[model samples]
Target: MKHYDYILVGAGLYSAVIAWHAKQAGKSCLVLERRSHIGGNIYCEEIEGINVHKYGAHIFHTSDRKVWDFVNSFVEFNRYTNSPVANYKGEIYNMPFNMNTFSRMWGISTPQEAKAIIDKQKSEITGEPKNLEEQAIALVGRDIYEKLVKGYTEKQWGRDCSELPSFIIKRLPVRFTYDNNYFNDLYQGIPIGGYNKLIDALFEGADIKTGVDFLAEKEKWMSMADKVVYTGAIDEYFEYCFGKLEYRTVRFETEVLDTDNYQGVAVVNYTDRETPYTRVIEHKHFEFGTQPKTVISKEYSTDWKEGMEPYYPVNNEKNQMLYQKYREKAQQQEKVFFGGRLGEYKYYDMDKVIASAMNGWEALHR
Candidate 1:
């Protein structure tokens, strides 16, 4: 039975940022997390002197200088670029379909040669692209599309590329340069210690209650706070009166290997139907650290269900319509504020989430 000026529903990055801002303004706050720990999906655990991303692979990338300065205030970020490699069967290719990948796929050294091959491949199509398959083929040509894009996109959405929308594969930019960096962001790195440390630092002076289901005792917490910042699913917050918005969930199979440096790179995506898992991530490679053993996880994207943890919001037309309804309802609620991925039903990287929190705080203050 604690009282505070504000109540945060989730201890994820969004809630942490809001609590940080609220505390900065001299307002008392309390954070209640359903899980035993903080950091939400971005939480990291240390294994063999390395930080393992417990939920999945999360890389911090942003172009906003304000966000970079704000996050750096809490913890130092190392120079880690996301240069993920793709493994189609036994062959390895550089990610983002860069020059290295082009060389590996077509034995082409110059950009002109690669462009010529792609033009020829694109000419084979008779008309405008209709679906994900045609769109990817038009953008990157046939060979790269089949070997890299096709199976991966199919696995991610649990549907054939031809059945999916063309917008889904509008353009996966293929850089002609030798750069293997996946993201085109101004700042990209991971916290030196771990994301867990960053979360702890953000909530330094705030009151936190873990392993507490605020929904079960909603009335009590509501009475304690003047305002509520909810980071959980918007539909769930209102008890799904308009039916559930669809989501594509991810399942991870993690194992600790006996040897060090399993899978030379940090992340290797399996973009073929033969492979059940989408990608394999060796956590230590992110920091290029040395250890006697390693831990790895194979990710599988599945259809969303009620009880499962929703990973990616399925943004098809149906879900969008449903989200619009929820948004209308959210606008009518005076005391509650909804932000973050689940609350907004939008896909967001870590930095985008931080910038969003900052924006929300600024609006609240104004």
Candidate 2:
């Protein structure tokens, strides 16, 4: 039997970063992936000479220099900015509620006109915002809320806007400028090739075993290392003794089109409730590919069930309290360290995941 310093439970970004840190510190690691591939949700599959984002659309955008420089060292990122368009019924508008969107909606120009319209409509919500509907109206006004926010959000959470909590729509981006660039980050781009290249680089020296379930042979795998870095669902790891944590998972329907330009943009969100899917992602636009064909994935947001792959945590009072119980139980265990979105039951963007793993690893050694 071969023993090592660490055995990572999942081959996602958190595990990959920890593995990278271990290699940097001259330690051996054995990485185990439940899936056949290594990159987890960030993993991409090549379809029609385009790197299709296997999960949903993921665009890297961050202002942190350390995390930015670290990933760039592995592969160069293209100048791909995320400026998604919203398709409501048959009409299309720019996302993030920018001036361009306002112009398209109201047939008016200048920030003054947009502000007047929004502020006038925002007056409808009196007192404290009671629910998502009120909160969204207070932020972006009734017209934008009805046409853009209400239907899409209802589909995403699988609930009426009035029934959902106000905290969910605490802030919706409304820019006065004409800039349609979705992110305000200093740097935003995709890797020169694809995300798989970055994952491969992060785990250059680690021994990886894909298509292996670590939890099935939990004891046997635990014996292979002094400590374990687990990136699976924390509630699942504990076997739901405290009941299952709720999540909002997405169902992807991806296909390759014979024509190159399908949507003419990377992301086009269907804001109308009539549409089954929330967004459609055209893979080739991320890299400015001139390939003869294009790949697209339609994302449908739904409530997560027992066996579905959990995409994001459903933030609410009930789930948070339940996660706290699992967290306290996890602290009692001496052998395993839990990290990542699912493990912690919290949403984390890409750069934040890398930064969190790096900080955790450094703190562990210190």
- Residues 162-220, candidate 2, lDDT per residue (tens digit)? 99999997799999999999999999999989999999999999999999988899999
Instruction: Tell me how candidate 2 scores on lDDT.
Output: 0.93
Where model 2 places Cα greater than 4 Å from the true spot, the runs are: none
The C-alpha TM-scores of every prediction are 0.98, 0.99
Clashing pairs in 1: none
Runs with alpha carbons beyond 4 Å of true place in candidate 1? none
TM-score, cand. 1 vs. native:
0.98
lDDT accuracy of residue 360 in candidate 2: 74
Q: What is the alpha-carbon lDDT for the whole of candidate 1? A: 0.89
- Native-to-model Cα distance after best TM-score fit, residue 35 in candidate 1, in Å: 1.2
Best by TM-score: 2
For residue 355, model 2's alpha carbon misses the true position, in angstroms, by 0.6
